[model samples]
Target: MSLHHTASQEATRRTALRLLAGLGLYGITMPSIGQAFASDAPGWPEAAFKAKTQDEVLAALYKGKLEMSKDVTIETPEIAENGAVVPVSVSTKLPGVTSISILVPENPYALAASYKLADASMAMVGCRLKMAKTTKVIAVVEAGGKLYAASSDVKVTLGGCGG
Candidate 1:
């Protein structure tokens, strides 16, 4: 190979090595990054995720009952053409919302998604969930240490999660 070609290859090798070294250093320096993903991290509702029924999930997560509320709003398609990727969004006007959870009662696991919000954070969450069939999509919010819920029925034409 020509001398110029050899030099170019060496430069490329050095650049790649530097990039790898930088990434390694980043991983070593960021210790909390690992903790953020740990399943046993504080406040993670492990039992709730494993619960089968909505009542069980609520008991596991909140240890209290939820009341239907007009302040909690659920925005989802009335009919989902495909059950595999139904978009769902939840928002609440209730003050001091600490968490939001989406539940699909007919799914193998009742809890589709759950998010913990910071103090004074906007009480809104959006996610896609897989549905086994047509079912009511429930949005539960924890505000001021109380549970509030809203639900909307979504008809799925195509089955998702093996219907």
Candidate 2:
């Protein structure tokens, strides 16, 4: 056999071995990739994401317990030229924050985004959200096993979330 042909065959064999290894077929066990990055992991609030009203979402996520707080801050543009990509950020001075959630009451689903913070992690998060129109953007922070919230108004010229 030609040397080039032999080298090509060797390369193919290595690739096959890699494929098998990736699939955990060669006496190896592989973790479920889906489970590793699933949205349905433990403590995920599925019902809150599906809630249509802000009250429902708050209730589903925080058991209807929330208080207005000045320590929580919401930063967003007063006017959003594009509703499809409205930038929003949340930060809190409250100690022992465990989670932060963003809510848009006018959107199809009031819950825009939610995040869980690790112990001693900074109480801050940022993301883009779609808006249906001019609406209040609320940031809810969970600290010391209690929920506190703050809100700001954002006006959208073009409707996102199907207007």
Candidate 3:
């Protein structure tokens, strides 16, 4: 074959190899992509998220499977001067943690936030919660097919959750 013809054929071969490699990578990653979407599947617990009572929300998520644990720690201000922006942090030393959830019992909705965690992630999460008044701020952690909880009292001086 002529020099130019061989060069053109070599370029085409390179392009074909690249296309196959790309397809192979996509096939390998497709399952994980589907899993990510499933984790975020649309029918998010709408009724549970909207529930006004603490017991109702807990039943929806944990099915009443909860126990107080010393391994879980909840950090919040002893007294929140601004109820609109009260910072909170939760972490657990327990193994096999799958999720972390925060709840403010006195707020209009008891379930403040819920996080789905991967096995590789740290068992710690932080977020700000609004408080209508002084109340217990609870952290629920799911680990090894069981739910564990910790709570702290935060006194909110300013109105939040339409206090």
Candidate number achieving the greatest TM-score relative to the actual structure: 1
- How do the residues 1-163 of candidate 2 rate in per-residue lDDT, one tens digit apiece? 1111245455755655576657656333333565564334333467888999999987777653678999999999999978889999999889988889899999999999998787868999989999999999999898888888999999988545556
Q: How many residue pairs clash per model?
A: 0, 0, 0
Least lDDT summed over 10 consecutive residues: which range in candidate 1? Answer: 1-10
Model 1 lDDT per residue over 53-150, tens place: 99988877774678999999999899996888999999988888888989999898899988878775799988888999989999999887888999
Question: Which sections of candidate 3 miss by over 4 Å?
Answer: 1-43, 159-163
Q: Which of candidates 1 and 2 reaches a greater TM-score?
A: 1
User: What is every candidate's alpha-carbon RMSD to the true fold?
Assistant: 15.8, 15.5, 16.0
Candidate 3 lDDT, 5-85, residue by residue in tens: 245445754555566778776455335743653432222455567888878877766654679999999999999978878
- Score each candidate by Cα lDDT: 0.79, 0.80, 0.77
By lDDT, the better pick of 2 and 3 is: 2
Q: Rank the candidates by TM-score, best first.
A: 1, 2, 3
- Residue pair clashes in candidate 3: none
